[model samples]
Structures are given as structure tokens and as C-alpha cells.
Target: MDMKKYEVGESILFDIGQKILEAHWQDLLANTSLRFEKVLDVVTVHQQKQGIQNVRPKNLAPKAQQAYFQTGAGQTQHLITDFFTDSTKIYQQLKALDSILVRNLGPEQIIWPFSNRPQDLLADEPSVPPNEAAQLGVRLVLSDELLTQLFTTETAKQYPSFAAFKNAIYLHLAQNIISNLDILVYFFGAAPIAMPEASGVKRSAIQAKRFLNCNMFQDFDSYLLSLRKAASEPQPKLLQAPLFLRPQKGDLDYRQGVQYLDLQVLDIQPNVADGVFDYQVQFLKLFLLFNVVHTTDPEKLTTAAQRFYQVANEDPTQPSQARPRVTAYLQEMREFATKFFPKTDYQTALDKMTQVVANETQAPTAQLALEFAQSGLFQFGQQLAAKNQRILTGEPYQLRGYTDKSLEIQQFIGSAIELGLNYRFLDGTGEFLQLRSQQQSAIINARITAKNPLILQAILADQQAMNNLLGFAQVAVPKGFVATDLTVAKSLFHAEFEKSGVVIAPQNGPKTAQQVFTTPIDEHTFTTSFLEALDYDDTVVVKAFIPGSVYDFYILDQRILAILEQVPVNVVGDGQSDIESLIDQKNDDDRRGRLGQRPLVTIPKTAATAAFLAQHQQNYQTIPDRGEQVFLSAIADLAAGGDSFDVYEEVDQSYQKLVLRIAQTLNMQQGHVAMIIPNIYAPYQPQPNSAIVTDVAAAVSIIPYSFPFAGNQRKLSQVIIQSLFSNSAKERADD
Candidate 1:
């Protein structure tokens, strides 16, 4: 085959676009330029250094006007138990946990006072220096000489800098790590406590104590009041601080208590890879009231949560195959739960897990293999499901091909121990398949596991893959087949020997598989195109099942294009208006905030602004160059640090016809001009009350700006004005 093809977005290595236009090698290669991705090892990132301040001993706090409860309004015993309060209880729980995964933490692991900090004590030495100072510190703790010292003994115990280095690394990883999602366990070495739930050192601790008296009826109101007060304050507090001592204000702020878990992937095909996987683990501690017997309270819960967190936070190896560390973590979990919360029992949980395995139901198509020995779904799949036998009646197919011992589904999930056996199939497994095409002999690992096999999804994907292999194309269909990757698909999408789904489909005639996507365009063509694609002598998957927001990423391109199509117009005003007073006098409103009466942005009253310059010209009292056009855009709800107005911008035409086309395509308001008032800082954005009208697209959204300076950036003063649609232009301005 002498054809060439290119993956969307990937630049062709050679001049294929021209070659394609010339029809070079289009027949032989079928335009399949053997597209392949060079698999990259995970990228490792170093975290920025940040300071940590944990004012210890719990007794510190400013006095409050009202009495606060510290021992907790009696239920403190049932939940997050802190063993440190009870020596005997602490020892007992520790002994129990030791049975599962014995830990050898030393004094260094404990919370040391400020006076003992190493940076304040030891001379400068690199992390892995070999000397008596290092040896003494090394043997004093659990690590061998090979393990680099995270912090010196003096540093580990003393103030200010003791755990600062470790906490900084942990924070760095937490902020940046985006592991492949295959890794189940992530560990961070020497994680210091994330900040508490409060702020203003004294008040934070005060807030922590008040948390105890919270209950159902009075509970929610109390939290709301406290949050309001917390927000009134300015500085950000750390997340790791226990709320009982000091509360970190924002649970949503991800930067606090960020930690890195370094790990290596085992069972990779190649011997060596380019990158090191940097991982992160979040210890989001929530404070809740749990009713418990005084004998079985929170002190135990707190202790267990900490210990469980600690074990899980142990540093990881490069490709942890044996994962003694991970097992140790599981063991820690069992030990912690069984020791204090013995009623929850270890065996009971393990036994219940086996139920997850036992519930596996056979695939419905297994009957096909039973009836026609040599053919299973393969017969129908090869015929593109045109055969009537492939049609389903009331009884669903019990897919049976994934569990064949010959194929060994265990290989994918062994590290995580997600040995799926149960029967959540209906609510699970999007689709199932064991496609065996000769096109690419390379075998890939399953990364998305299913609670039940995703039989339908797999069949669709396999069908599409086979079709693509056959050189048939699937035209773009709106809201078409997009894949929702479930962890079960990656972990337990397996095949076994007993009733294996791994059988290779026999050679069939050439077929094509195509995937389609769409935006907010007229649904008429999209609907027809989708159904036609579905029945195109191949297979179709309506894009519903694919989860998350991956669909949004695709249509953003259309969004940009839609913006470009709007009719361009400039801002202008009434013929008779003073340029100076016009800047301030433009019809406008101001809102009250934490600060009194702030105009959302530079709402132009003057005429000198360029928008004013272009629109009025010398005729409108010599186009006052002082201000800009203002849209009735609400200033502070969601975007630009505001909320979604929920009010769709009014569609207008006339002077803003261009705005209408762009807005309609983007589903935005056609005429509302979202203006910008640049703060002239690092990053810039539209001023308050100045968002360009958008549509349902903005409804499904994420925060557009997150960097530090997002708030202070200046707004854009000039912007495009356009009509929303074809006919509405003249009718708008007359109103």
C-alpha cells in the first residue's frame, strides 16, 4: 500500500498534505501512515520549596468571648481517636498494627520541638554524606546508608527548619503530579502535617476546639458561621494542620499539604524507559461528628487515620513489582482497623472482597460459542452485526471470554490487588471484547477495569478498530461515540480459559471503523450523520457512556472558530454627549463588595477610549478618547473571579451583527460586548461586568484561571462587537 495518513493534531514528518493532494501512495497504504505513539515514561517534577508552620502542643490559642468545647461534646471518643492522649490505648493499637506491617519509625518520625532542628544544629552536608554524623543519624532511624537522609536528626527535632524540607517536597509533588492513573498506591517520605482548618494561629486552634460541639440541627449553621468568619480573614493557612488544633480555611485549595509519591511502574515491556514517574497522595482530613460509645471514640479513629496515612506515605521504589511496601500498607490498614475497631474485623472485609470476585456473570454471547463451537460474537462481528443471529432478544448476553486462564487477566491488576470477581456487571463493564486482528501483533495492557465487563463498549471500540484496519472511514457525527475510561477496564478487563473472550475473530472482509464528535451546531445534520455512521456497514457508539469532560476538550476548537466568524463592529454612542462626562456618564451601575462600591472594571464614561474613538468618530463631539463600551454583563458571579450570570446574554443584531454570528456559534449572547480592563500585570482578563456572552457551554465548566496573579490582572478595553444571527441586525438597535 502506497498511501500516507496523519493523526489529527500531529504534524506529518514529511510533506504528506501536498502528497495527499497529489494523491501520492493513496492506494497502497490506504492513507494509513502506520500511525504510532512513542510511549513516554512518566515525567518527574521537582516541587517548589514552601514554608510550614505548625504551632504544636495544642494548648495555644486566643481567648474567645463565648465558651468553646475542646474535649468535644462527649462524642470525641467514638471517632478520629488520638492515641497520644492515652498511653495504654496507643501502645495496644500500635502493637496490633505491627502484626500486619511492622513499622520501625524512630524518634525522628515523631513531632519534635523547634529547639532540636538540624539546620540550626548540624553543619552543612549533602543528603547522602557518609560519616559518623550521618551514620549515627542513619542508625538512629530505620533507613540504611543507601537511603538518602531527608532531614538531619538535629533538623528533624528542632524548630522552623526541622521538617520544612520534607514538607516542601511533598507539597511540590501534590501540586503537579498527574500519574497515569494506573498507580494505586502513592507514598511521600516524611510528610509533615498539612495545615489545620483555621487561620490566624490563635483563632485556628480556637476553631478546632469549637468543632467538637457540632451536631445535626445546630451543626450546619455553626459551620457556615465559622466559614464566614474564616473567609473574612486574608492569609492562607496550611491544610495538614488538624482542625482541632488549627483549621486550614479552604478545603478546596489544593496547594496546602500537597505531597509527592515517587514510584516506578513494574511489568513494562521494555527494559529501560526515558522518564521517572512522580506521584502525589492527598491526605484530605475532614472533621465530622460520629456518635460512638465513650469506650470506642475518635481518639482511636485519629490514631488509625494517621498510622494508615503514614504507612501509605512510605517512599516507593522505581518499579515496585514485589511491592512489599504496598502489602505493608494493606497490612497497616488491617491492623489499624482490627486493633481498635475490631468489630469491623479483618476477615470480614476480606471475605466481602471475595464476593466481588464470585459475582462474575458469564457474557450473554457465550451462548453463541456454545451453539456454534467455532464462532462466538466473532461471526456477527465479522458480518458487521448484519446477521440476525447477532440480534438480542430479552435475555442479555453473559460475556465469557475475559477470564480464560490462558490469557491471565491477573497480570494487569496484580500490583493493585483488584482481583475482580464479583457481579456489578449491569452497572459496570461498558462493553466487552477480545479482538484479535493481525494488523498489529503488539499486545496492549488493560488499564481501565470494569465492575462488570464493558462488553458493549469493548465491542464498539473493537468494531471501530477493525473498521479502521479495513480502511473504511467514519464521518464526524455530533455527540458520537466517545469512550469513558473506567478503572475497571484498565484493572480487570480480563480474559480467562474457562470461558475466554480472548478468541481471535476469523478473517473477514475489509471493514472500516470511525468515531465522530460534535458541538452545539444545528442538531439536524448531526443527528442524521450519527445514525448513518452507526449503520454504515460497521458499528456506531453514541458518545454518552464516555465519562468526564473529555468531550469538552474536542469542541473547544469549534468554539474558537465560532468566535472568529462573528461580524466585527466597533463601540459608539449618542451623537450629542460631552467626551469627558461621557466617560463617567455611560449608563452604568456599581456593586457593593467586601470593599465599598467598586466599578466591576473600567466602565467607560469618557469618549477617548478606542472603542469610543472608532464608533462616534469626529462627528460625535470628536470621539472622546477616555472610556470604552460597556456590556450589561454581571461583574462578579463566576468568571474573572465571579460566578456564571445564568442569564444568557440577550441576542442582538444591528450594530453588533458580527457578535451575533460568533455568539450563536459559541452559543453566546450575540450583542453583549464583554469588555476587558487590563490591570497591566502579568496575566490579563476582561474587567468585571465584562464577560463575552457564552451559552450552555459555560454551564459545564471548570475554573478558567488558577495562577496566583489571576485576580490582579488588568481587563481588555477593546473587543469585537457582532450580530448573533442573519436576520436580527436591523431590529435590535431601534429598540
Candidate 2:
């Protein structure tokens, strides 16, 4: 990597010409009729070093070289050779450009001297040949087959003239130079040349004003289209001219008397020995460009890009500082991409996130791992592991060697890790995970456990018994009866179901809303018959359907840690769109994805939804009035398409106190108590039918609070870990 210093000049005319060339190439690519897959391949190639090699004429076969040399700068020619004198000059220019890597910019701001510029130059220097100018030169290897395919007369008719068609064919040889120029401005040390009086806040404000005048287009091509449609609006000036690094001091004497952005020295230097900086720069460039290509507004895109750059460049050595910021940026970026380009070609960019997963061995499990890792939950596990010297066996974050763990077990692992509890596979098959500390341990199979596992069986098998105990303690519990058979179930619910619907579910196992039957008294016979036909002999709990939203109170160490309120999956209507269209738009939210893919499950539009809508005198095509909310499901089960909100603080403190009393009655160290209440935000009262405790379980999930779909995120994992650790410490002291 030989390098030489040169007195580089800032060539304004050359810079303008370069920008025009890049813009022209961009327009050509955007409007071309060529297959996008081929175009994507070409764009991808331009981003790689190897791609450069493939495009060089000398690297091609001798026969191909002959075709390249025969091409001329004409309508039929397919080569770019206007600026370069020869191939040797091309190599010299590129080699000099790469030297920008060596520049010792003291403080990273918005500019740097060309890497080839002399380290020590005078304050007032004159302009000379630019050393950091990027030049892309190539000779197209024309084959008989390629010529026939590209130069077809039929293709010529699509354009205004044969010359226009030939120009389009020739443009294929032009690399995506605008992307390269952006790389220089962002990754390399090129500083943008500013207008005479425009710099800093004034410049930004002016640009923002101009941006507001422009129509809010979805992308660059759309922005171009808007210019033609809204011809009445005054045309806005381009924000800044593209400029490369040059040899100059702090002042602007070398700018040919034109004022430009003042260059600053790069203050912080990075260790580039391992190519880490290079990799980061490349990834950041691609990531930002993907957003830029998909983002709806130019002003927003610029702000986001600059914000990302600030986060990355703030402290390169301590990347952990940037992790949280980067995570926030990516989350916003995901929402933006999902909302704006749900069905566009660029939407595939979101699909390509697997490449970033880095350690994803299996698609399903790795995806879950990736979600927790990004949500900041893994940070708790990582910090704990580092403090305890325990081995966490997964890849990337070291949780396991394989991905065969059930989704439930995977979630438990994440929770256990966050709680600072080390886990061991009880058997070689990895079917069971044992979460333990020095003083206590618990086994988690399909169901997660608390510090005490003995009470789990009784708690899971009989919700009716738990409710009876809660009621005996004078705690608010749902009024229900246990039915041992179909006859008993019908007898218990026959009267109540006529006034309000009754819910019947198995009493001998953990129940899901899907497994429960909710029907009116007239419909009770059908449900009772269906359960009997399935050979369900276990007693079923028959309870009057509580009319309200459901809230799950997480009790840890005999106290209410958090409360999560869930509502049936629903959409609000705008005046113009049908319910079906509204659902599509709502489902476009990235957070509302399939189970295990995101924090929230997507609202399903199925037969059940159609039936539910029909019950409300509506259908999928029904266009409800503005500001109307239409629910698609009857139950507030996340897996069945429901939204959750953190109501831990929102719930009245009196209700919180009552929940603690209920926790005490259950004697739960860790448990979940679900209640159906009309309004959690209102203060609790001892009314006979105010709130009904729907279900209680010994095992509790922290995910609802850990990565909440809406409202403030709660750190339940940390709280659980600290509490359990304290309990273990107290027991050790007693010993």
C-alpha cells in the first residue's frame, strides 16, 4: 500500500460535472425497462471490491479484450472513456483515492483532507489537480449475442429515436456513481462544498424550508415526478454541491475565492488494523442507503442519516455507547419502511435482515434470539454472565449450541438469563432447561417455574380452586362453578348464559382462549356436545363472561410487579377506507408480526374476524365512519391477535393494593393473575360485579413488559432477578 502526498485542488467545475454524470446515471437506472433483479445484481456488484475486478477490461478474456478495444464514443459504442487518458491513469487515480484512508483527520466533523494530500500544507494554498477525485472507467465487452439483444430495433421504438435507445444501452456500463459519491461524503473524508453565505444552522433551516415547499413524495423518483405535477411551486435549489477532500488549511483561500464549508480535523482516530473500521463503514453505508431508498421524505431521510452518523461517529472505540442509539434508529427505520414500502420492491430490504443476525443457525429460533438481542433484554443476560463467569451457550450471545429449543423454552432461557440465573440442560437431548443459582434451582420444561416448583401443579390444574381460595380471603374473584361433565356444565351455565354469555374451559390443564367455549344459553348445548364428543372428561370451569378489557398482573415475591392491559385486535376507521383496507394498513406495522417474530402478533383477518364483524352488523368491506374502532376478535389473547399496553402505573394504586392482597391469598412468589375490568385506570371498589378475576397461573411471562408493543417498557426481568437473588442471599445468611 504505497502512498504519496500531493497538493490537491478543489475543482468546482469538475465536481459539478461529476454530480451531473452520477445524476444522469441514477435517472437512467430508475427508468430502465431492464429486469430489477439484474439491476439489483449490478448495484450489489458495485458495492464490492471483487465487483470492481470483474468490470475491468484487462481482467476479461483476450477475446473480450478485443471487443472492448474496438468500442468507440459513438451512438453504437458501449464504453465510457471521455475523462480518462488511459487505463494506467485510471489505476493512478483510484490508487490515489484509496489513500484517503490514510488521512489523519484530528476531529471527525464534516470534512477531511484527501489522504494523498501533504500532511503539512500552508494556510493559503493554491488549487492544483485533485488527488481524491473518484473516477470509474470501463470498456464494455461487446459480444455478438449481447449486441443483438441490446441493440434490437424493436427496443429503439420504445424511445424517441434510435440514438436515445442506444444511449440507454450505453448507460448500463455506467456504475451507480451517485452511491459511490455518497460513500465518499459519508464514509470517506469528502466534505460537501456549501454556498457562499450558507453554513451550519442557517443552511439547515433554509434547506428545511425548501423541503417543506416540495410535495411529500415517497421516494426520489416520486420527488422528481412531483416536480412536474406541481409546476406552480417555485423550484428549490439543491441543498449542497458534492465536493471531495483537497489540500488546504483551516481557512478557505484555496476555494478560488468562493466560500465553502470550513474543514475540521478528525480528532478521534480508529484502529483500522483488523479492517473493523472498513467493515463498519461499509455496513453503515449500505444500511443508510437502504433507508434512503425507501424513506418517504427527503428532509426526514437527511435527518435520520445524519443522526445515525452522529451516533456511529460519536465514540468509535466504545461501540456499546452507540448500541442503544443504533437500536432505537433501526426500530424507527423498520416502522418507516414497513409503513411506506409494505409492497414495494425495496421491502425486501427488511427480509435481508437475516444477514445481520450473524449467528442465526435456525430461522425460527434465531429470529426470536435476534428480537430479544435487539430489545435490550440480552444486555441484562450479557452483563450478568460477565459478572458471574457462567457460560451462556448460544451463538452470538452464547445461550446454546443449537436451535432446537421450543419457542417457549427459548423465551424462558432469555428470561432466566436476564434474571442472572445460569441454566443447564438436564439431559443430552436438551429437552429440559434447569434454571439455578448457588442456593436454589428450578426446572423449566414446557412451563416456566418460580423459586418454588411444588405449588405449580396445584396452581395449573385447578383455576376454580385458586379462585375459591381468593374469594375466601375476601379478594375479588370471578363468580364461577366447576362442572364435572357436559350435564353439569349445561346446568351451571343454562341460566347465566341467557343474560350474559358463559365461558367453559377444561379445569385440569392450562387453558387458552382458543380452547375455551363462549356461548349464549341457547348455544350452550352445541358447546357442551362438542366437548363431550372430544372425550373431555375433566371438570370444566363455567364462569359468566366478564364484559371488559383483560389485564394481567404479574406478582413477583408477593407483590404486583407490573400490570399489562390487553384489548382484542382492532382497527380504527378513516372516512375513506374500508375495514379490510384499514386492517391491511394496521398489519403493516412491523411490531404486529407473527408470533415469535415480533413483540405483538398481527391482527388476523380470518373467518373468525368475518363472523365477529357480522355480529356487529359489519363486514370486511364495511366502511365505518371516521374515528370508529372495529374489533376483529372477541378475546384479548396476544397469540389470537390482541394489543397490550403497560398499565402498571396507569392503574389506580388502590387496585394495585387489592392485587397484592390477591397475590398473598394465592401465596405466589411468581404468578400471573388476569382480571376482566371495565376500566383499570379507575379506582377499585368492592362492588360484587366490578372486576372479575378470570385466570391465575403460577408461571408468569415478563415479555409483555420487557418488550411491550405499546406504552412504557418495564424491566420485569431485572426486578425478578434482583428479588430472587436477594431471597437467596437472605437464606444463605440465615444458614
Candidate 3:
């Protein structure tokens, strides 16, 4: 990157771009003898052609830049093939790192192209926040007014459509990207920089680091308002769960002053990783081992633990002959347990299990170990002192436990063993997609944990085997949930297994179909997408296309339009009603009996919090914070985790007819459902696992789009489900 002289109205902050490149790039080429000047010229040429016309070209010479890139697609290359043999592995690793960031926040979260002028911002101590609330160091840098101005009627008229206009405006603003928030994170956030000619670096989240799009927790004020509301409400509704909303704070210096087009930056401290990405890409059962990863000579730890258990159980004497490995494994297990929950009594759970295996020559020691690993109970029971330390980085999320479902997981394992289909979770999606490194994390309530003990043996194998071992679909392991299944998986699949699972057609339907009808401005026709088009707050029009076979399910009597919204009873308002009164009123009237929040059984610091809100202009009788509204308009079938009621029937026949017509317009097919989300039911509901930044340690559930692959969550069924469903699938004789 060349140091460019700015225009009369321009400024250049810190050369963060260079620093970013140094950290993520320099190492790969430091020892190489090749020159990178031509590569630099190409990059410079494109950069200038695109938008950066003001940059100085001298820094990007023909010689200094070619050390890494291979420019001119069809031109012959000089880079040696000797080092490229493991390029796939290297590429996969980089992708893994990128996936980690995206899984936590999002693919769009890392547009941190940053540049601070003359002074460095991160170097400052106790980073000054833009808001009065110092706790949540984040804020809204851009106003809704700006978006409106960019994509208003005038721009839409000129462009012929709103979507096209939006894209054009976004591009225009991005072309001239400049924000302190962007610069700040670009320098300090752990985003890797691009290597001049390295296409691989740009494969994942890290690649977009150069865009400088500013996806930080800039929407702090909104998040703060949401959090405070969550606190004031009786049931801190799941709608306002830590994930969907940003945390609250008290400092107030944040204002992206109207400098370049009055572009202001908001600032506030966050309680969580507001831009958290890639937490639930895969699910896995976890097992933590205290002893050596590999079995040792003399006797395995299980043998030792078995002897200890037998002595402790029977003789309580003559303990010298006990297996030492078992005792060691048990000690480590105890230490792990102590980390989360300390108990001075009965310190032999691990030891006893191992000892039982050791004393009985025919005992299934390996199978037992595999069981704990798959069930992940050991990981669950123990807590992490530091949330970032990962013992298992890439393991499959599967059913494991002492239940029927476990039998399924085990059966799956056994089938895998017999068929030898190379299976893994954190490896890659197209191949061993089920077992890739991106989703593996040994964290709390993880769908997939840090390590797959069953994989320990497989992973420790040679690299050739690891690379060739791809994932398969034409197979089902009914015993995937089995506790004592240790069938070594092979590299093949059964033909019948491939065709047995349910087939869900990818869902697709009408968008906000824009039709210029005369009634859009006058009649207020629900048949047109215009009702949803002009939506101002707390509303959404979910368009689903169900086949006729499922038609009755939609029109069920128990089906009320379930308004899954952020708890609206947030502000009772005025001075007449107390919080209890408001809570009672809301509970009595709302279809949902108890709010979708943890019960007020223990309000923690309820009184103090109320007093604090009173200090803010909010009255104790009235609600304060109002989080942005998000509603899930689903049928209230109870079984679908919704309440009961049928209010849709009360609407005028004309309205009902229009609703059905609108559904038809959106390709409703023969089966149409009635779960309408009127402005009345709109509430600011936050989605699950929204606490990306804050509650990294908490075991929050995963939402559909929020998770990596679609079916990545089914691996968490209880033990009984695993044992019965997983291990029982009939095996075919492909042998």
C-alpha cells in the first residue's frame, strides 16, 4: 500500500493498512527470494482505477511486491511447486480462521478498512467513549435520516427502484469510507490483513478486513436502550436476550460530528462482542481427558483406574498393584471438575470408571471413554476459567449420552466403522463437511465441542489420510447415540444409507414484489406488498409457500397468529400503575401466559435497578428502554412453542380475503396459513444467541440463520432419543 497525498479537504490518520499487512502477511514471504514489484503495480493500478486515485504510487514498486503474488492469470508462474504440495491444508487453515470470525458475528461484520490521521487512537488508555454510559462502549454512528436521504423517493425515481437505489448509495458511501470506529477496530481488532497477491487471505472474514465497511457495535444507543428495557421488564423476554441487543453503558462523548457530510460517530462500551461471529457452525459431543492423549506402555490409564476402583470397592487394602494410569486420569478429571464445581468428597468418578475397565479383562474401556467424549457430559459438567481457551477446535456435533438417542449416535459410529466413510465435523463442508475445524469449539452448551475423542485416534493419523477422508450423506447411524460404541469409521458409505433421510426442498418465494397499482397510494390494498413496504417499526411480512398436503395444518383451530415480539409491556407509562400492576395486566391480557423471559423468581437487583432508571428521566411507574422490534409471526399451535388464541377470525371478510390474496401473490400455492402480524402485535424482539460479544461463556441456544449449516443443531437431542433413533437404523450389506 502506497502512502498517498490527500486532496485539500482530505486527511490521513495512522497507516494501519501497513501494520495489518505486516501482522498477517509479512511472515509468508520473509524468507522468499522472489520480487513482488509487478504484483504491486497491478494492485496499485486496480486500486486507483476503482476509487483510491489520491494514493502515491512510489511505495508500490515492481520489485518489493512480487514476493507473494502471481499476477496475469494466464502468464507462466515462477513460484516453486515444492512448497505448494500442502497448499490445500494451508488454504483450509486460513478459511478456518475466517470462519471462526464469521460464525460469531457475521460475514459482513468485518469491513474494518481503517485509517486514523496523525495520531493513533488505540494507544490511548481507557479508551474514551462517545456516550455518558461508559459501560457499553458503542453507539450509533449513522442516523436513519441518512439512509432515508440516500434511498428516498427522489433517488428511487431516478433509479427506477428502491433496491437498486439502495445498492448505489451504499456503494457511493463505501467508496468514500471514513469513520473513527472503522479506523479504531482496523488497528486493534484481530483482523488479518491481505497479502498483496494472496487470493487465499481473502477467502473468509479476514479478507473483508480491507473494505473498511464499519460493522462495529456502532448501533450502541439502540442496543443500550434495548438492554435497559430488558432489565426493567418483568420477564427479561428472550426477545431481549443478550444476543439480539447490545449492552448498556453510562458515558456520552460519542458523536460522529457532521464533518464529511455531517458524518458523526457514536461511542459506548459493550458488555458482549456485539459483532461476534461463528459460534455454532457445528455441533459435537465432547470428552476431556486428563492423562496423556495416547495410551502409554505398561498399562493404559483405564487399567490403573480399574485397579483403584476394585481396591476402593472391595479390599480397601493391597492397593500397590492398582493401575497408575487410571489414578492419573482420575486426578486430571477431578482437577477439571474442580475448575467448574469443586467437591471435596467422592473424588473417584474418573478413577472408578477406569478401574472397572481395568479389573475386568473383558470390559469395554475404549468404548466407555468414547461414550464420555461423544456425550460431552464431561465438558458440560466442567466450566472454563477463560472462555477463549479451546481444547477441542474441530469435532462433529452428534448425539451422545446414556439414552435411546445415544444408541443412534453409537449405531451411526458403528455404521461409519463398518462402511468406513470418512466423517468429521470441522474439516470442510463439501467433503468431510460434517467434521471441519471452523465449527469445533470446546465451550459451554456447544452443539459441537472442542475435541472429538473418537477422532483423537483418527486425527493423529498421517496427513494423507486426513486430506482424503471426505464426508458422506448416503448413510445413517441409528446407533450414533450409543454410549459404548467405538467402531473405527472407514472411508466409504452404504448406498441405501444415502437415500433414507427426509428431503426438504429449499424454501423460496416472492419478495416484496413491487407492482405499480393505482390502489397502492389510495385503497391501502393488503394484496400488494405495499403494506409491508412502508413498514415503519416492529413489523415483518413472512412469506412461506407450503404445499397443499399441509393445508389443514395451517388452518387449525388452535392456530392464532403468534406475535413473537420483544416484550411490548416494557413501558406501562404515566404514574398511576406500579411495575407489579403492569406485569399482572400484561400477563392477564396477553395470549402468551408467562412472558418468554426467565421468571422474576429472582429479580437479582430489581429494587436498585428501578431506582437507577428513576434517576434517568424514566418514572418508576413507566417503562424506559425500547429495543428495536423483531416479530416472528407464526401459527400459535402450542407445539411450535407458541401460545393459543384465534384473533384473525375477527378481521373483516374483505381483510381476510386480501390476506389470502397477498399470500397467493407471494406464491402461497394450494396451502395457505393465517398468521398475520399487524402493527398491533409488533414488539422489539431479539433473536436467540444474540449475545455474541458478551455472554461467550453462557450456553445460549442457536437460531436458524444464526447457525452455520441448516441441520447443524439436531446433534443435541437427549440420550434416550440418541439411543433409540441413532443406533437402530438397519445396516445394509454393501460388503
Considering every candidate listed, which one attains the maximal TM-score? 2
Give a tens-digit lDDT track for model 1, residues 38-127.
111111111212112222112211122101111121111000112122222222222222111101112112111111122211223213
lDDT tens digits, residues 310-356, model 3? 33222111122334643454455456444422432224344444454
- Per-candidate TM-scores read 0.17, 0.45, 0.19
> What would the per-residue lDDT of candidate 2 be over residues 1-735, giving only the tens digit for each residue?
111111112112112223324443332222211100000000011111111112212211122322111222110112111123222223322222222211211121111111111211111332222222111112222122322333343323344433333322222111122222222222222111112211111111111122222222222233334434445556433222221111134422222111111111111111121111223322322343232233132234354444434432321112223334434544654564444334433334433433333222322222222332453322322232222222211121112312354444545554554343556568766557776664676565533544655765576577666766877877676567776656655655655565566665566543332333344546545464438533553666666666687888888876787789988778898888999999888888755665644556677778868987887799999997899988886677777667888888888887777777877766666778788777776788888766777877765556566666678776564455556557767887999
lDDT of 2: 0.43
Worst-scoring 10-residue span by lDDT in model 1: 284-293
Query: How do these models rank on TM-score, best leading?
Result: 2, 3, 1
- Give lDDT for model 1: 0.22
In model 3, which runs have C-alpha deviations exceeding 4 angstroms?
1-656, 668-735
User: What are the Cα lDDT values of the candidates?
Assistant: 0.22, 0.43, 0.23
